[model samples]
Target: MEQVPLRKIIHIDMDAFYASVEQLDNPELKGKPVAVGGNEVRGVISAASYEARKFGVRSAMSGAQAARLCADLIFVKPNFDRYKEVSKQIRKIFHEYTDLVEPLSLDEAYLDVTENKKGNPSATLIAKEIRQKIFETTGLTASAGISVNKFVAKIASDFNKPNGQKTVNPDEVEAFIEVLDVKKFYGIGKVTAEKMYQLGIYTGTDLKSKSIEYLEEHFGNSGKAYYNLSRGISFSQVKPNREMKSIGAERTFFKNLSSEIYMEERLNNIAEEIERRIKKYKIAGKTVTLKIKYSDFTLQTRSKTLPYFISDKGLIFETAKELLYQEKLKDSVRLLGISLNNLNTHQKKFVVYQLKFEF
Candidate 1:
């Protein structure tokens, strides 16, 4: 097997992205506790400013709860269009350094700068330059992490946030990971962290001590992933605009429905939503899937692969309706969802237009 070269990977995350954007456009909100969401009883916060974070107000928390955390918390509705435009501007900056940029979301992206246009040998210097350029161009701060692989770099990016950067040299990878809490591992979620805690695995060092067989027995396929990640090894590459494998939306209803007529009505709305998303993303799939959650908490899915790709709203609704009624109901249905899959293969197009960096 050929040995892959040690690559320079940098993960760039904008500081409190959506909230920061809100603050940038509204100068009055600067240095004040602000949250972006619906300020209603059941409304959830989408983003919280650094000032709001100090009071333990956070994204995904209920708006009512957030208000309680910070009595004077300012609520601002999110403007996704404005956020998308800012994200585009930030990506243009990454292109100036490397073409291998993979955006994680509107707030963060991974850049492979192993071989860059500037001929700079130091990834640390490149990260510093990127941060400076982002601040100058967007009036927004970005925190960056530089390392030999994406996993470590992504974790490092959050180390010193709100306009800071950290770099883990190749020689320092092991020691850097050794002391990290398992909960801090990017892929370990809350549930997994609790499971690890039960197993007496609190940190990377503890995880590293587990034998592969033991990990596999405990975590199944994820065992190998945890094994490699704990040792600072990542074979994953910075894939650009990875293909859309599936597109779907689901909802859990407040009241479960037993009538087929009501179920079909909900399915129609879900199908329309899926079609809208497919059009927005400029992608379509051949397979149509219908998902159902029963009042008893049991779930089931039915799917059919079409002979042709489709993006039409009418056809999506019709197909979903047919799938919904294909089988008799076992109990009252609580949720209905539709998704498109087996995506159409698209010719990858790279945007050639480039704007020169002023700095």
Candidate 2:
């Protein structure tokens, strides 16, 4: 039987994307602790610079806590338009090497360069060239991970960060994953890591020792994924035209509100944002989900699927309004979000083509 060749995957992630962009545009902000988005009074940090990170500031952390951590933290309002422009420039650089570019967000992407336009034999060299091109083109630094598969590549990318890269050879894959902490696994979050720890699964080796049945019993569908990932096995492809499952916008209020009227006003704004996003992507959705987070950090989601897809702001707002009143307030609400799912952007039918290494 002829053997299938290994793939060459590279995961490229911009270093402190939002915060770095802020510093690049304003030279004075360089070498200083910077944060993009939010104020000390309200909102959360969208991104923090490496300097701010030294003080334990992190994305999704409340601005107040960030300020308490670093009194010198400089807060800058987010300019997504500018960030998107830079992201486009970086993506253009990736296309020079390969078209199998799957962007995870504005700041990171996975590229399948096994059969690239450049005919480059070394995935490591391709990753280096791509990162260099990104720095030269946008004055931004990117870190990369090169491996035979996307799962290991994504994790390896973070091993050396803020302008660095790591390459996991095919022979080194299994051992590299063995010693890694469960928390460092790409899909494993803090909550899942804690659960794994409680089960005495602190490292990849420990996780690998568990039976598939045991993991599935505890983690359900995700357990199967964990089992595979522990053994350095992942079959996920780098899809250039990855589907957007949902589009949503949310806001966290500075103060918790008890009034439904105030919440309605906020929902209108969020609905408008959602409409804009769907329009930008030229898609509509049949399902409108209203996400509410109480002051105590409890979350509630109420969804309504319409018979037909809709993307108008007025229509979206009306649906969200219905959901808002669908249930009474449990506690003073701290956040409100509006999302549209069951989108009109249905998956396109295509034949799968596997690109393999020559060797």
Candidate 3:
């Protein structure tokens, strides 16, 4: 008998997640540049719809700049609560296949389908199925990349966007990397790639020719990671760590709120989402945190740890609401969030938490 290895990984990234969500919920927003983010004079854009991109709008840019770039840019603040619901649905889909799923953020995740729950051995098929499920459930598209390793899989997923996919077979690994831009290599960000360019390392083959010492001299530990990734060698393993040392959810509103009625409504939703996730895992925590993004995009978080753990929605909202009121910022509220942390040790024992937050 011959021996075979079992290491299959896939990366999933939602295309313009927030903006897509707005389009999904509002028929009129499709095909139009939509920016979902802060509107305050000082706030920055959080998500830009595909339509908005044509005008050079982007997330995390000054709202004013995004507006100036496209006079027609329609700004719809993020509906985090709804997005979380969609996220939960997608996560359920992932769990149906593998428990070893790691969600890096609200919009991205990695799945270790090595020994998937569905008994589906083909990682490519699993990625396809997951992307399909996400589209069907959320009315938004996702891009997926499948490969034997995470780095290749991540790059593969990004190869196509706004609903795209790519896969890299193990045998074609080195060649797949050789043609990639140096910046596409794992751990190679814009700045680092510029430095690599200065070293005349423009492609995987160029980086491969350099001695380990040369790369180390230039990039430190990250250089080592880049070198390994170029060869399709990733030692990273997928583990479930969901209980979370901290649990939090945030949403940017479509319009800034100066009234308590609207703010409370949104805050309650944020609290409820946290509570729902906490209960989904059958865990509780003593600390409650409230996060706020003012009209200017200036963010702040305040938290308090109670004497005992709780999963009560009302209590969590109240604690967070009070915290928000205390801040009493002189600006409109653009975003609100709630979080739980410092769980009782007993909570950790019963729940097999899967960790998905990754870089």
Candidate lDDT values, in order: 0.87, 0.91, 0.80
User: How well does candidate 3 score on lDDT at residue 6?
Assistant: 30
- lDDT for position 325 in model 3: 77
Candidate number that wins on TM-score, 2 or 3: 2
Pick the lDDT winner: 2
The weakest ten consecutive residues by lDDT in model 2 span 350-359
Work out the TM-score per prediction.
0.82, 0.94, 0.68
State how far residue 313 of model 2 sits from its true place (Å).
Answer: 2.2
Give residue 33's error in model 3 in angstroms: 0.7
Candidate with the greatest TM-score versus the true structure: 2
Question: Which stretches of model 3 miss by more than 4 angstroms?
Answer: 1-6, 242-359
> Clashing pairs in model 1?
none
**Model 1 residue 233 distance off true place after TM-score fit, in angstroms:** 0.2
**Cα lDDT of model 1 by residue, 192-223, tens digit:** 99999999999999999998899999999999
Cα lDDT tens digits for candidate 3, 185-274: 766788988998998989988888877787788888777777676676676665567435878888766668888778888989888888
What TM-score does prediction 3 earn? Answer: 0.68
Question: Model 1 has how many clashing residue pairs?
Answer: 0
343: Cα error in model 2, Å: 1.5
- Backbone collision tally, model 2: 0
